[model samples]
Target: MTISSQSARDLTANITALSDKSVALMHQRSMSDEAVTTFQNILQKVQEIHDPKAALRSLSAEELDVVRQAHSLAESINISVLSDEGAANLLNAPGHTKDLNNDGLTTIGEGNMLTFPPDNAPASFKAAWEEASDGLSTMDIPTHMIFAVGLANIGREPGDLNWVNPYASPDYDYGAAVSEIIESVEYQYNHNMMSFEQYQKNMSFYNTLTEALA
Candidate 1:
């Protein structure tokens, strides 16, 4: 489930936008009915996936076991993207191997400009890009998977694995491990481990996910 450099940047940008929106929503003391409903739905989805206590009990035994394992692995990561203390580490995350413009286009980097062309990205690269984007966009994934994928995107490129983790210089494949956990969540979803209501809750579970991880 490792992500390519381009995918990593794109996912990070998307998550950042979501986080920004969450923050904005939090500042409003009185929100419109629609806004309140949206907020509640998001929060419920997040709780469903990230909260063990609130997990859907409808899943098969095997699915539940796998979900537990993935949840445990997700819980072990200590990096908190929300805290000021942890923010520096996040900001210093390694750059992508390829060039990513603020406008969401991926490219190849040179001295001052980026080169954009179909040939610049091979079929494999394009396929991986599509897969990562599609997987992340799905409502079936948990918040842990989202963070894991983002981390994977940090170093999933062909040669970028060498520079993946700043904290642990070598020997660890955090991205791969996290991606597996994400896949496990998907497996649980496919297996009906949780009800649609519970699966739906994880969409807004970022706050709960952050809190649980904290």
Candidate 2:
């Protein structure tokens, strides 16, 4: 990441804020409280990072995974705004696509960006995508289907088909997949991201008519 002095400080503030917000949301969602508290306590080690710029990549890969896991915990449970912009300025870098998780696919960046699988994508990747995306309109819920496909394997090479299975999945188990669809459909409705008919259609995709109307 090309760093200007101003941008470096901005990124620092963003990461710090994201960390704080992430912790708060974890509590609201009644996540594994003891575990979340312990995990964040470890993040305090970052305070030893004196220089804002130095703090950018100061985290080891494992540590970085911890942070992402924390945020993704909240995200896959429902939806998350934690990745908005942070020490992860990589999303803002001009013309650069990075697989932050080193999952081999770099297209699903912050904000759940997308790029189709290469034709040569492994059989596993194709299969995971196909299963998660089955029977859904590629153009419509391709983005939303991401949750069912497994947020952890967004670009994971040799993708795991069980990415959606709770016991084997990488996402938090506090909610159901259809709950995500329900929440997103309501969010779209409240925010006017879609029309009423479209919102109904989205909800009905996974929920029964009674549930959708409810």
Candidate 3:
């Protein structure tokens, strides 16, 4: 899903307002230190979520789900704390990365199959793969996914010419790729091309991919 610039600004403003209201309520209710800390942490996350310039960081699915639920509970406690629309918008906001719901995996798999077509694969597979890859090309690619694809390329064959290692030590290429990926993700985040949640998801997906591939 895509969020227009204006919509993003509106969402950010709404979240900030809601957080402020929640903070006020916590103070009014004389919440315990632990409870206050929880609210404060949630507020910090919400702020980071709406800030386009924030650094890219991984956010687990559970964390986001919890935040969404907490926002809902806060609204229920004080209707003025958060509007229905604001809560919905925050929950439905587009992710910061392009690897939403395994799209990255699909793209990588399709690309690999197309690049090294299996002898037993049918022609129809190639046609379908091409169609899927073409569609993905039109969307913004997450930096982490790009790095993953590059790593996959390097791992495909010992001496594959497609692998370009810019680092002085070839052994450090993977580390360099990781650094580049982080920088690219941050650039996209700062540019508002992707949401903070999406960025987090991309990082989480990348970590999983790395583990499995390793």
Candidate 4:
């Protein structure tokens, strides 16, 4: 029988956790020879799931049943666990790096997958905005600001700095205003003690609104 997508995903997660633990033990120089051997065995099982062999090895009905049951049990377990170093490592990944450009401008986002302006924009303000707006539609706020703003700023108008200006004219740079909000959101994200996923979700909304209006 084939493994369900959910089952494979669950197993992959457990195996990842196991891999993490094994790596830790290696670093600490604390694993016994037997423990190391057991870890390798588990890794092989994980690889079998990840890289299935083309040849279907024969198994007794009972053996197949046991494998099915194990898969089910793995799925039923809660998987929202964070390892001791999960938070620290997540915040420090290459995606979360905060190095700004020479212009003191840089995009910041969680987990790094998206980059803004998509490496291509027309050489005009309207073309840039249109392209940026299209890209922003697919991006979460954390990613757009963190990955795209530097590119967006290539030759665009400077966003407004005085957000509290009650008399700010209709010509007020709303892009800058949205940027300030994003910056504030980032401030709270890095300073507060909250789940990274939650922070990312909240910032997604904030960014969506900003990008939509921009």
**Candidate 3 ranges beyond 4 A from true positions:** 1-172, 207-214
Ranking by lDDT: 2, 3, 4, 1
Worst 10 residues of 3 by lDDT: 101-110
Q: How far is candidate 2 from the true structure (C-alpha RMSD, Å)?
A: 16.3
The top-ranked prediction according to TM-score is: 2
Question: Candidate 4, after superposition: displacement of residue 163 in Å?
Answer: 15
lDDT of 3 at 38: 52
lDDT of 2 by residue, 1-214 (tens): 1224444344333333234455566555554667465445544555445343244356565545444455443332211323322334331222222333323233322444433332234445445445544677756543453443355454653334423222232333223554766787798799988898888667655454224323
TM-score of each: 0.19, 0.28, 0.22, 0.21
Q: Which candidate would rank higher by lDDT, 2 or 4?
A: 2
Give me the candidate number with maximum lDDT: 2
Q: Rank the candidates by TM-score, best first.
A: 2, 3, 4, 1
Error of 4 at 127 (Å): 19
Count of residue pairs whose backbone atoms collide, per candidate: 8, 0, 6, 3
Please list the C-alpha lDDT of all candidates, in the order they appear. 0.34, 0.43, 0.39, 0.36
Q: At residue 48, give the lDDT of candidate 2.
A: 49
The count of backbone overlaps in candidate 3 is 6
- Position 75, candidate 4: lDDT: 27
Q: Name the lDDT value of residue 134 in candidate 2.
A: 62
User: Which of the two, 1 or 4, has more TM-score?
Assistant: 4
Q: Which ten residues in a row have the lowest lDDT in candidate 4?
A: 84-93
